[model samples]
Target: MSPTSDLLAAALAQSGFHPRLPQQRRLYEAAKAAIHQQRLGAGGKLPSSRDLARDLGMARNTVIAAFEQLAAEGYVVSSRGSGTYVADLQAHSASMRGVGATPQGRSTAPAATPSARLSRRGQELTSYAAGPQFEIQPFAPGDPDFSSFPFKLWQRLQNRVWREARNDLLDYGQSGGHLPLRQAITEYLRISRSVKVEVEQVMITAGTQQSLDLCAQLLADVGDTAWIEDPCYWGARRVFQARELKLRPITVDSDGIAIAAADLATKPRLIYVTPSHQYPTGAVMSLARRRELLDVAVRKDAWILEDDYDSEFRYTGRPLAALQGLDHDDRVLYMGTFSKVLYPGIKVGYLVVPPALIPAFRSALYDLQRPGQLTVQATLADFITLGHFTAHVRKIRQTYGARRELLRHMLAQKLPRSVTISREESGLHLVIELPDQVDDMALAQQAAMQGISVKALSTYYLKPPIRRGLLVGYAYCTPEQITDYGRLLGTIIAAEAAA
Candidate 1:
């Protein structure tokens, strides 16, 4: 038989339309008809493993196995050095057609009912949306210039870890993460952030998002109120909302989240704050406000979630001590992530819970979550203990600080008279307040068209529209890119203002 015929026969047998195996014979017969009817034809390569896998909702290996089986049956022929090909089975086509025949002509099958498609609850969440084409610029908040990351050093460490890893390293690691990593984190946080916690108090998580989710579950019940900053992190709001916890927006000024009469009125179960540098509005919580917040948490019997994100990149004098350091009442639940200092893809973060909560927190994490790769964690711990992590952060801090200055200078020179930049002291991002008349959403969309991605501050608010502004990040952008991004953003703002 020719290769085409041989392939056709093999495909038929592989599909299982044989005289035996009655359970799947109907499907096999149907598939055979589709092939004969030119629905699947000669000279056409079989569907890719992925496509077949999807169609059958089976693993790719299964489809590949079936194809191999067909080749073995001599219905399909495998070329000595080429891919499998259909056998020209013209001789048996007529006979095979009769096997599945009905009096009407060919047996017809019932159509499959469509299954419901799953979707995420709200509108598709993205940092930027499609819009006008602006100049290619870097405006994404909190994205460090990935190009500056020590790829060579990281690869060397990764290679070393992989070479040294035992067979056990391939298995599921401790849910609390690799022990050495936890110890390294404990030591580092104690020395750097002044956090008083042992390795037992720390729980490794898949970065800040997972840490926040775990915290929300552990600390608050459904319907419990969680106070977030007015111009807070949108991601945290999403996390809170997903857990069905009520999010109350507390107003923020130069001193961070204002925890006064209004915050007390909400009777929040947990208060989430980015004390080191507030999100969107880059205000650091003053010493007085931090003290007051700790006191309120104690008085109200509420837990304070200190999201000490981006504290490592403080450009000014020494970074402020974490609120966790000052909390004598054990009210602070500290969260930190390597995403800001390193790459987000690392997915390593630590949550420092009060001593009382450690046991329960570890148990919850153990029961509900699986640990990340053991080798990665162990290697990272070695990196930190060896001082590479500190050195990398120090180098990047200077690079980002210079980039921030360039951005600030460009903004001052190019931004419209009506727009004002706020809180440039310490963080990867700065906020630019726009006029009330300009719609931030429209401006963001317009800027996106110019190939620039800028965020609108109004989107972060839960209640009480606070400030209309753009949260521009310069960390990932180079000095040149920062200048260009600022200019593009200024142009967009100016055009919008003129309009």
Candidate 2:
């Protein structure tokens, strides 16, 4: 059959629409739409896998796999000499008219099914609207400007680690992490964040997400209350929810997590806070609130998990001390990630527990956590100890600071008076609060149509009637891209407000 015939046949078969996988279903729907729209006409040759992949902005393998599946189902025909062809779909259309129904005249698929498997706790999650075009922007949250990383210095340190590393580095070094890296982290946290902990108190995790998971496992029993911030980080909330913990959201103010007059009726066993720079909202926890929270934790005998992600990128004024620094009763468990400072793919983050809890935490981690690659940890330790890590942080701090300023300036120029931009002092993201009339989720979806990615703050909330705001990230985008993105976002927001 000709290429057009094969394409038509595949489209016709897919129109019957019993896709086992959601991704496969999406591909089938897209293919059917293309055929029905006459994009793939009878006798017309279908595009090559490479061409289709390029056009669709998908992996070549994905396109090839889709085509192969279609061919296997007798929807398309492929030959050795001629390219793949659309099958004569008209021959099958009549027979497929009733294929949507089962033999007993009922729908084959259920109306509702279980959701996809949950990702690990605290994993960096991209918004639903984030696509290739969204990624093309300069500074989206959770991304570091990899181009700014000092690869040459990193390579040299890696070489040295390889030269000096012992055979034991090849094996599983430790459940906590490589000893040297743990030692380095212990020292670094003590000096930098005022987190008092010994090398034994530090446990290396896959990132902040794993740290959250480890904490959840160690402290929270199912159905226990875990207090999270209102409009908090979605990943953390999901982690708590996955463990079947009841999530209690506390409202946040300018100084950060507002625990005053909070409904403690649930009597939460754990409190998760991003004190350095609050996630999404970017509000720094004030010294008073930090002290108040520590007091509350002590009173309630609750464990506090302080996620210090992106604390190293403070652009304006001095960096605030970590919440763990203010803990007097050893109730705070501090978590830090190199994912933001070094790179995301490194999958290296450290958790500092109280001295008394170290043994139990370590024991639990060893039992449940998969130890990271020893060689990488050893190399990373050498990088930090040799001062390359500090130097890289210094360089990127300046770069991110410049980009933050540029983004803020652009927003001020483009955005209306009603739109409020929050806390551009530190971290990769700023929260844009729109007028109450505008729906942030709808605005984000609309922006996606224009190839601009923006996150709605409402999705992070667990309670009903969510807030309306956008989380704008600037870690990956360049200055120019930020300007363009700002203008585009301003236009979208303005249009939405008017509508």
Candidate 3:
């Protein structure tokens, strides 16, 4: 078939014709849209009725009837012995435009550029640096090993969900998510992370990004103070900025956020922290610091947004108990995502809110995002109850630990001792600190050219006084790739330093 015929065939097959509409009418509408959109250009010859009918799995008569209608409507022209050609509508289109009328003769308003149409808030939100394009390369940060996932088992569970599907499974789920899934998450968090929560306080989100968006919207108002950890997760930062929250970057030290006495004068409405394993820089918040922050939150009447992302992959000592567990005032909004532990495509995360705010958060989530994925949630619940979730976590922790060691070893052997590698005991990536004079951004670009994916640590900071380093991820890369790429990256870093 010709390209035009193939395009039309795809259009016809996927146009989602209404059940009540006859096939001929559907075909006529689809064809008219193609012509009006100029996809079928002027004088473009259409396929023969017989060819079109075979391609679309319709009767030849149906195709002929549709074609006749289109020609009658001046969308096409049929010749004596030649194929039908798309009619030239340039003159008609120009005439309509001149009179400020659309092809359907509706009076149209003046067209405005996208920037002009957007609100001031929209422009500010768009101006922030959206993270990388998520390319899968040597050391792209926070990416899990997709090949290691048990797809067959996951498929079997999903198949079972559909096989025994109920009306509730197909319909819109509760704003708080599938009850069983929420219960499962509650149990898991209580045992694994020491997150004290009931199923009623749990709300399912698409991911941490959605959870952040919801919290920013519901917990705080526009222009209200939001304290975010310096050099924080860009995703959370973006969410707060989008909600027009006034962000105060709190400096992070050896123990998570170093809250100074002066810094607490202007009380914040919300406090965002990754106390488990800080992003880019993997500083586990000390127990003392956790208690201090909790006390501060209570004193200031602030809500602490504890993002326990990647807490399951701790490789040394033990995974620290979540900061939420220490909250006596129930002011902490604990968030966790399956993206880091499972795969990113799962698109499932949970936020454990305070009991009092449950109704507000649930209603707001439903009204704003309309969260639904009951089938996936059901299968995930089954996977957890069957002990597959913990098993998977154990299996990947060993694999990632090995990869992390190999990459560290390779880089240590190749790079100079002057380059200081962070000794954080957990998380997917490691930060290699550089001298103040070395340009980490330029080094990152040069490493990318060599096919080594690493993020510049300087870029993570919200304000200046930034530390210079590169975040090299080991969770996604295999031993062989890590060894090879680590050597190349080491050489690149050494050269950059010498220059």
Number of the top TM-score candidate: 3
- Order of the predicted models by TM-score, top scorer first: 3, 2, 1
Could you say which candidate leads in lDDT? 3
| Candidate 3 lDDT tens digits, 1-499 | 7787687777767746453589899888888888878899876788999898888888999999999988776677676466677766654444335543333333432233234445678877777756558568889888899989999999999999999967788766756899989999999999989989989999999999999999999889989999999989989988898898999999998788999876888789999999988876888889999999999999999999999989999887778889988888999999999998899889999999999999999998888887888899999999999999999999999999998889889888877767888898789999998988899999999999988889999999988846899999889887889989999999998887777
How big is the positional error of residue 353 in model 3, measured in Å on the Cα after superposition? 0.7
For model 3, the run of ten residues with the poorest summed lDDT: 104-113
Candidate 2 per-residue lDDT, tens place, 347-377, comes to 8898999888878777777777756477889
lDDT of each: 0.75, 0.75, 0.86
Q: Is candidate 1 or candidate 3 better by TM-score?
A: 3
Clashing residue pairs found in predicted model 3? none
Model 2 scores what on Cα lDDT? 0.75
Off by over 4 Å in 3: 1-108, 129-134
Q: How far is candidate 1 from the true structure (C-alpha RMSD, Å)?
A: 12.1
TM-score of each: 0.73, 0.75, 0.79
- Enumerate clash totals for all models, in the order shown: 26, 17, 0
Candidate 1 lDDT over residue span 1-499, tens digit each: 4443344345545643564643234333444455456555544555454565555555667656665655444334444334444433442333244432222233221111111111233333222334444443578777777888888988898899899857867766654778888999999888888898988888988888888899899889989999899988877887887777888889898888886676687778889999988886888899999999998888888899999888998888888889999999899999999898888888889899998998888888777777657788877888898999999999999998888788878888877778888855788888889888889988888888877788888887877566788888888887777777788788778778777
